[model samples]
Target: MGRLYQVTVVGFKGERVTVDLCNTEEQMSSMTVEQLKTKVVAKLKINTELSRISLIFADERLDDDSKLLKDYGVQHMSVVQLVLQVDGGRQL
Candidate 1:
């Protein structure tokens, strides 16, 4: 894990999912928000086709699957809030 960084993904229940994102001294190599979501799902053993995963950073929802994480101001060592809506879009 050389030249990597940590982005702490904290769930609604205060659960944490650690993801070691690959990076360089400059910017990230086109890491998309969807990829991060995938890692979160795998780490937490959540759904494969997650229709309920949400990544919130700086009080803003990173809803675009095609967008990069850095485009949403998600820098290294950032704390992203993960909200998994259970029971059909309800936070349960």
Candidate 2:
């Protein structure tokens, strides 16, 4: 038997998107931050570079793509906040 959990991706104005799922605990832990971000971008239907997307969980910023979800102790049904970073310099 395997463990399955959901990770919801939320954006501005309560834009909810449930796109991350793991077939097993091991798989979930092995999943990297970048992988989740990619899924979010696709599910959210946003055309932006991977670097432009920032993920936040438990009031902590997930800035390392190479790090696994387990590194942050992501729990079942974890709510990940998506922040779309603007590219280039300021518009001043």
Candidate 3:
């Protein structure tokens, strides 16, 4: 079975859209945040560039110096939050 992931995209309007990674593999393990952003862009067929969005990785590890990743190892069914904030004049 392929690894599954829950990606939540939060908009500026306080609306969230969750997409499921059903047929995805464990490729995220070997990819950086930038690489993963590219994948997400391609997967979602986003017209804008992937770098235009803010990608947040919340894993299962928390450090005193960093609050980015939590202490919950990301697994097959991990749920991640992606906040997509557009500029004031930027429109889809």
Worst 10 residues of 1 by lDDT: 20-29
Model 2: residues with Cα > 4 Å off, grouped in runs: 88-92
Cα RMSD to native, each candidate?
2.2, 2.8, 6.7
lDDT of 1 by residue, 1-92 (tens): 25787699897789887787776735464788888888788787776465578889999999998899888988778999988776756763
Kindly report which residue stretches of model 3 are placed more than 4 angstroms away from their true locations once superposed.
1-29, 59-75, 89-92
TM-score of candidate 3 versus the correct structure, residues matched by position: 0.44
Deviation in angstroms for 8 in model 1? 0.3
lDDT (10s digit) by residue, model 2, range 24-68: 877787899998888888888888899888899999989999998
* CA lDDT, every model vs. true structure: 0.80, 0.82, 0.47
Backbone clash pairs in model 1 (N, Cα, C under 3 Å; residues 3+ apart or in different chains), count:
0
Tell me the TM-score of each prediction against the true structure.
0.82, 0.85, 0.44
Model 2 C-alpha lDDT versus the unseen true structure: 0.82
Sort by TM-score, top down from the best: 2, 1, 3
Candidate 2 displacement at residue 74 in angstroms:
1.2
Name the best candidate (by TM-score).
2
Candidate 1 wrongly placed segments (more than 4 Å) = 25-29
